[model samples]
Target: MDFNENFVLGCSAIGAGLAVIAGIGPGVGQGIAAGHGAAAVGRNPGARSEIMSTMLLGQAVAETTGLYGLLVAMLLLFVKPLVG
Candidate 1:
């Protein structure tokens, strides 16, 4: 490939790497949320519905960050925004 093409690919790879880094926050947050949810369930099994609903809602919201990261990575890898 040409020097410019190689440079763009390298930059895209770096951008994808940086984009994927965003997933860490959602991952850690989801894990903490899940742990707390499990603990809440253990403490009060009767409120399972409420606890589950709230946990799922929070997890889904938190997961958006990871989704955005994945989207950015995918765009970098596949969409080839820097190609043109």
Candidate 2:
């Protein structure tokens, strides 16, 4: 490969790595929410609906950062700027 191609590939690899770094935040946050939901359910058998709703909302918020990472990786993988 040309020197320029090598540079681009290196940058793309870095970009992909950077994008995936967001995964850590969401993973930890979602795990926290799940743990809390499980504890709440265990403590109160009649509040499953409320606990599930809260868990879903928290998980959805956590998912946003991960989605951004996925978008960046997709762009790097399939949306090259050059045509030739």
Candidate 3:
């Protein structure tokens, strides 16, 4: 590969890696949320349904960040927008 091609590939790889790093935040956040949800459920069994629904909704929203990262990494790898 020419220098330009190599450079593009390198940059794409780096960007994809950086994009994937976004997953860590969601992962940690989800874990913390789950822990709190479990604690809440334990403290108030009567409100389990409400707590579960709210937890699920918040987790789903948080999960979107990881999904966005995945999409960005996939685009960088497969779309190759930087290349001619």
Please identify which of the two predictions, 1 or 3, would achieve the higher TM-score against the true structure: 1
Question: Candidate 3, which segments miss by more than 4 Å at Cα?
Answer: none
Ranking according to TM-score, highest score first: 1, 3, 2
The CA lDDT at 52 in model 3 is 96
lDDT winner between candidates 2 and 3 = 3
Error of 2 at 22 (Å): 0.8
lDDT of 1 by residue, 4-51 (tens): 787898899899999999989998999999999999999999999999
What lDDT does model 2 reach? 0.85
lDDT of 2 at 84: 35
Of candidate 3, the 10-residue stretch with the lowest lDDT total is: 1-10
* Better model by lDDT: candidate 1 vs candidate 2: 1
Residues 1-84 of candidate 3 have per-residue lDDT tens digits of: 555787888899899999999999999999999999999999999999999999999999999999999999999999988877
Q: Report the CA-based lDDT of candidate 1 relative to the real structure.
A: 0.94
Please report the candidate that would top lDDT against the real structure.
1
- Which pairs clash in model 2? none
**TM-scores for the candidates:** 0.88, 0.82, 0.86
lDDT by residue (1-84, candidate 2, tens digit) is 545776787788778889888898899989999998999999997999999998999899889989899888878867854323
